[model samples]
Target: MADEGRRDRCLAAHEAPPVPPEGPVTTRLPRRSFARSATEVAPELLGHILARRLPDGVVLRARIVETEAYDQNDPASHAYRGRTPRVRVMFGPPGHLYVYFTYGMHHCMNVVTGPVGTASAVLLRAAQPLEGMERMSIRRRTDRVRDLCRGPARLAQAFDVDRSLDGADLVRGSEIWIERGPGASAASIRRGPRVGIRVGTDLPWRFWIDGPWVSVSRPAAVLSPR
Candidate 1:
């Protein structure tokens, strides 16, 4: 496995525009689409498009660039505590949002996966703004497009995702939804230890594109030993 240094290194430059989706613009990914376990879904999330439609019909979209997986057996996962009120969504029918307020301030989001009673999810880490840059910047209070959604909390802020969106169906496009975008092969993806966790920190569950400027700036050094 690549060490932390290599895992956290910046990827090669990718300056090209997003490749057109393979089929008709995806409106919503199906419920069964995310029935796989979190580890299996995390890497596959890269290059997908996440969108949220506003009251005025404004649709904001960002291309997912990074993600991390968590499951019930993982000590760091919320579900490890076993079916608490806030974590109940993680045991789901899949393709639903599992949002939580963290640090008593910022909100982070995850896509529920696995079986109905299996708690597993993929935390969206960063994304490349694909549409509605102006609103995203306004919401994020930053003019730097690159920083709009460069972290889990930041992604939630930029997309206006919060507790209100918890358990929202992603397979339905009425509000928030994930659409199929381009797919990246294993050669184009990299894995790393999960971030900002004191437990299960050694699990190499984090995945990201191997060559995309849109990814968050990797830490100068690994924060924890893996």
Candidate 2:
């Protein structure tokens, strides 16, 4: 497995720096595309590109591989307590970035979804690195392509995402925006309990491609049990 190989490499060269990617900027996903419920948006996000372009013209790109849905009424969501200073953007319209700092150490990003006044979003989990990986390596301090964005916090670091991007318009062609890229069919997507939480963990809102590399291991029960 790729992960096993990664373990071996890490044991051998855990301190080695990663090689960055070199490429042109890829297109961004349209703004209108995010006008859907968080549940409808999560699984569909797989294989799409989430990109960040620097002022120097270096474009960092990653293919979204995993996500988790957070609804207004979900007990596990930040907005479950109603809107506040930190979660205000999540209550806004769709297609905007809802970034937040977590653990006092790293940032995580989510795409605001659902109708206006609805506090729902899809947490971007893992992504497959595509462009400008050299810089990503510098930010993440690792050379493993799979390790670049194998988790949400790591994804933020790999793409230079942080609280400053909070409420940024994703559909507005800005420094950070999502662009249409490869996507999987519904059957190719899987769902399981959300990670790192006790409340609402059994909701099965987490979604990911079945075979692609992922940050988390597959849960024991696959939703719908194909």
Best by lDDT: 2
Worst 10 residues of 2 by lDDT: 13-22
Model 1 over residues 34-69: C-alpha lDDT tens digits?
Answer: 999998888888888988876466889988888999
Reference-based lDDT, residue 161, model 2: 75
For candidate 1, what is the TM-score? 0.83
Q: For residues 27-122, could you state the per-residue lDDT of candidate 2 as single tens digits?
A: 555555677889888887888988887546688888898999999899999999998999999999898889888887989999999888999999
* Candidate 1 local Cα displacement, residue 3, angstroms: 45
Query: Would you estimate the TM-scores of all the predictions?
Result: 0.83, 0.84
Which residue pairs collide, candidate 2? 18-143, 20-133, 20-134, 21-133, 21-134, 28-179, 29-178, 29-179, 29-180
For model 1, give the 10-residue run with minimal summed lDDT.
Answer: 10-19
Which pairs, if any, clash in model 1?
A: none
